[model samples]
Target: MTIAIIGAGVAGLSAASDLKGAGHEVVLFDKGRGAGGRLSTRRASTPAGDLRFDHGAQFFTARDTVFRALVSDLETRSHVAKWTPSRVSLAHTGGTWSAEPLRSDDDWFVGAPSMNSLVKGMAEGHDVRWGERAIALSIRDEGRYVQLDTSGWQGPFDAVILAIPAEQTRELLADTSPVLASEAAASVTAPCWAVMLAFDAPIKTGWDVAEVSNSPLSLVVRNSSKPGRGNDETFVLHATPEWTRANVDKDKEKVAEELSGVFCQMTGAGAPSLAAAHRWLYAKTETPANSPYGWDHAQRIGIVGDWRIAPRIEAAWQSGHALAAILID
Candidate 1:
């Protein structure tokens, strides 16, 4: 069967790989410039060599036997690496910073070069169409397909997978699958504002990763310390969900200025050499997914994503794998 998977994220790419291994043809589409979805990365060139930043997910843990094996294989292939940063949770309560006790003990893993590398490796040897935004969904000739915003309708596929975020999925599949659309619409994923800062001079920040609380900023990560990043004092700051929603509409420069100032105060990193901001409308999940994945056998429409399971990189891969397994079976 030919499968048209939307969103070249981990989940969608995972589904495409498994289904192809089972002797099925798979075609993938993504609105983004490349794959990996929230498993994103940013690269910049400065006088201090090239710099990299994982602006989306900082790190992920492997728990499931399947996922553990997958990550191990990636590690063996040098596609991913173990990250053990000096992490501490900080309470910014009362406008002061206090180090709190660590919470989780699980080891974190990140892409070797950047988070997107993991997914890019997964998408290798696949017919992936980038910059293909699905504008609408339709069904005809007893098959389902999506109408690209740029390229008109392309279809007659055996299956269509909605592997994008919940909100985008809801908007795309509202007519084809109303029930799933409603569920997608009901799911709550919070927005986030991420700032990537590159510094020319080294700063004396003792820790590599700091999770902040009771403040507008959420987490501060020293990007240079990652496994395969440049030696510049690069940092990434993530805003809290509440703060992101409140200021999501603000201009990027304005938000960057505000957060860069807060980061300098928090870490004493001094003024950034260069800084950029990005807005993720659906950054993280606020609620857990009740279902691992959704499949309508009659409609031949499947839905899988991190939002379809627990919020994490593993869940997203599992969700897509589950849906593809069911379909292939």
Candidate 2:
């Protein structure tokens, strides 16, 4: 069966890989220029040099057996590496800020060069239509079809899988399958504001990653501290969901300035030579779907994403893999 999988993120790529491996023809479509939805990287030009930031997901852990095996294989292929950054927890106390050491036994893994490299590696050898947004879906007498924003309607595939965010899946399924659309609607997601900072001199914070409390910012990472990243004294700051939702409409420059000030105050870092901010409307999953994946046998339509389980790369992989397993069965 020829399948149309939308969204070239981890979930979509995972499904496509498995289905194609099972002797089915699978094609993927994404609106972005490349794969990796939340597992993304941003490049910034600075006087020091070109800086790379894993601004989306800092790092991911593989608990499931299947995901662990895949990660082990990627590590052997030089596409991924274990990240052991010095960790710290910061909290605001009575007129003072306190920092405590954070320790975890669970292994953390990141893409060798950038977070998106993981998905790019998984998306190898697949027919992926990049820079194409699937705006609508149609059902003909032959099979299901998808309408791309640029390339008209394409398909007559046996099945159509939505591997995008919950809201996006809901919108796409509203007309095709209302029941599946309602399932997508049940999942809730939150927004995030990310700020990338590059400095002329390195900030001597001692710790590479920090989890903050009682602040607008949630997590701060020294991007250069990660493995395989060049030495460029770069940092990525992620704002709290509440803060991001409140300031979602603010100017990007202003958002960068405000977050930069917070970074300086927290770490005593100097003004960044380059500061940029990005707004992610569907950044984090607050509530997930009831099942691992949603499938409507009558319409041959399905939905797979991290929002169907937990907000983790492993969950996203598992969701897609689970859907493909059922379909193959």
Expressed as tens digits, the lDDT of each residue in 171-195 for candidate 2 is: 9899899999999999999999999
Question: Which RMSD values do the candidates have, in order?
Answer: 1.5, 0.9
After best superposition, candidate 2 residue 90: deviation in angstroms? 0.8
My TM-score estimates for the predictions, one after another, are 0.95, 0.98
At residue 318, what lDDT does model 1 achieve?
92
For model 1, how does the per-residue alpha-carbon lDDT over 1-329 read when each residue is reduced to its tens digit? 98899999889988998999999989998998886678888777777677777999888899889889988988988888998888888787787778755646787998988888889778888999999999887788868778988888888798899898999888888889887888788789999999999887887767788888888899988888889886777889999999999998999999999999998888766789888999989999887468988887778888899998787999999998898888888
- What's model 1's lDDT at 285? 89
lDDT score of residue 143 within candidate 2: 99
lDDT of each: 0.86, 0.91
